[model samples]
Target: MNKRKIEVCLTPVLLPLYDIENSIVVVIDIFRATSSICYGIANGAEAIIPVAKVEDCLNYQQTDCLLAAERDGKVVEGFDFGNSPFAYTEDKVKGKTIVLTTTNGTYAISESRKTAYQVIVGSFLNLDAICNYLQKQDKDVLLLCAGWKNKFNLEDTLFAGAVVTQMGLDNFEYDDSAYAAEDLYLQAKDDLSGYTSKASHGKRMQKLNLEKDIAFCLNHNLTNVIPVLVGDKLVKM
Candidate 1:
């Protein structure tokens, strides 16, 4: 078995209880947040400043950066954008710095950054980038899933599984949570979009009339941008 250990944090609520110090934390909010961040970078954003609260993002907006804020899966009032990948088009975010606040993803990122030795944003959009980076870091990993409103969500958990399975497969031993995530991912590997369509969060987005986003978030390895935390900002590595 490989010596490296990887743990998947299925939800953000449990982040406070975990001892993640000195470990690599991969934050996943596949439905939108991280995916949007990746798009923002790949499309050419200089950096992304992830804030937990809309007010914090608002504070940054005075600095000439684009702001995107979301609350409960919808665009927050008076923000330039919401937590949607398509909203981060080249015409909008390219060559600019963005301040982003999402309901769950950005909150999880702020929380996980507290003690993680290194924090990297992950999403299906940059899946291969994350897997390749983990292979080199050689540290214990915690896939911090930004679950829907701090509760467990299938899409995030599945992305974590994709990471673990890609980085080493059965070569490394992991906790029950990692195993469970892997199992779920394997079951859905052949049809990720189809599988995730049934998820609660998926249904939630559908209610919001964001059906195209669900498929966009599931598209894999489209970009090689691996967003790494560099002094309170996420920039491409």
Candidate 2:
């Protein structure tokens, strides 16, 4: 029997199911995590190693990796950069190894490592690239959303909808929340942020004066890099 592609929405409240034995895990944290990775790879970061904790990223700092981490929308005390796309630049990141840890996205990715055959990070910036890759692969793909502090967020779900819609999967099942996200994405169409930013995480980022970041995260297909997790790092493919 063909394995089913799963769409799992992960929040701090819902327990993480990272048992990725043979599936592809597409981790989505649209507010910043995936967006930053996309920026880093697009701007020329040779590879991004996504660690579960700041210490893991730090361990690599002595080696070839440039650390980038954030907690609660702020830079971690000792990382090289925070979880912001703006930090990645052609001049700074080109040919560099970026080690990243984020409050939600990294943790979600780490958890997904258990079950996914391959764990790939996803964002609106690389939407088309991700979809195009998935279309050619035969594995059952899982869409994992890194929700805010254990609560469901709209932006990640909308991204999931955008992905599933574009893939045109024939055998798919949506839980209540997944269906809601799909419906919301359709309702919003091209105005993604307007549709999903109603979530607390989006509002909090905006409150912190990051409306531009929100807009940037909502732009579909702006980048061509597909960040795939290799062993412990997410590298451009």
Candidate 3:
């Protein structure tokens, strides 16, 4: 056996336990959160500086940069945009600097950077491309999910499962929770749009009237740009 391990952790709680030294960290925050950040970079946004606090984004915006953020599935006050894919157009984001903050996603991204050798954002939008990158790297992998309000969210875990399945690796270990997530994704892969509409986080977005954004985020393999953390900003790798 090669002793390769694949660990899927729920949030900051399990984050510290994982030995991410020299490993690749796939941070997932489906439901139009991190997916929007990936799309922003893919569409030519210069870089994204993710902040855990809304105040931090506001402070950064003082430097004449664009600010985008969300909380409770709604756009934060005085922000240029919310965490939505439709907002990331070439006209708005191309060659621009984006300082973004979200309820749960960006915080996870910021925290994982400390332990991860390379932190990459993962979502349904860039599934195949991310998996392809992982295939070329030999390091251990940790799939970190930005769960809802400090609890496990289905969409992030499902996205992780999608990655595991797409990679098609046999030399890996899956905890019971990971197996459950993988199984959920396997069942939902055929109809991701339908799956998201029913997921807990998906329903939350639905109630907020952003159902279309959810659909866009669930569209798999739509991009090849891998957004990696470079210093304080996330740029295309």
Candidate 4:
């Protein structure tokens, strides 16, 4: 059997340093973006188109798409929704195509487009599905963290560690980054929501009165929706 390698890139800025040409890239934006993707798809959204910029999302306005745009934790004016997980409820998002843009998450997806062999969105909501999918691939796995503003953030790094821990691959080769992430996850696995609630991003969200969104994002395996990159949009597998 071929040895599979699992690695963690703490931030999108480090993606260029890795040879991800044919690797499985798991994009994690645990705070809201990837989490919202899970909720939206679970609630019956047709598909999600993640754009890197607000201007890119405007084109979708011509259609019946729901536009979710966020920058620096605030919903952009004139957009249909914000990055909050609760914003994607069954009644509102059902049967609609969502066009999304955010400060970090969408950019990470766009970055993985041409380089990665496969791109899968990861959040606590679909954590199990992501790990199960990677185990079956038997390919080198790279957990790409959609850190705040291309800078390292605790929540995303913790999510990377959680992935490494969940993968639990005996034959897996991982680097120091992965080692650190795994250790962090092991230390906090028992009270994941409590541990993450005090993170910087968590604090930021809390100040915005988004405790509900934070709680939803930190829940484990709430959904099995694994959003995979299909051309330019993300669709359920």
| Best candidate (score: TM-score) | 4
lDDT of each: 0.88, 0.78, 0.84, 0.89
In model 1, the Cα lDDT at residue 94 comes to 84
List the candidates ranked by lDDT, beginning with the highest. 4, 1, 3, 2
Off by over 4 Å in 4: none
lDDT digits (tens) for residues 140-219 of candidate 2: 66788888766777788888888777765465544555566667678878776676677788778877898887887787
Best by lDDT: 4
lDDT of 3 at 222: 76
Report lDDT (Cα) of residue 108, candidate 4: 95
My TM-score estimates for the predictions, one after another, are: 0.96, 0.89, 0.95, 0.96
Q: Residue 138 CA error for candidate 4 (Å)?
A: 2.5
Against the true structure, candidate 4 reaches a TM-score of: 0.96
Model 4, 110-216: lDDT tens per residue?
Answer: 99887898999999998988888888885799999999888888888888998898776686888899999999989988888889887888899889888888888
Off by over 4 Å in 2: 1-6, 12-19, 169-177
Of models 2 and 4, which has the larger TM-score? 4
What's the distance in Å from true for residue 77, model 4?
0.9
Q: Ten-residue segment with the worst summed lDDT in candidate 4?
A: 166-175
Per-residue C-alpha lDDT of model 1 across residues 101-143, encoded as one tens digit per residue:
9889998999998899999999999998888888877688899
Runs of candidate 3 exceeding 4 Å displacement: none
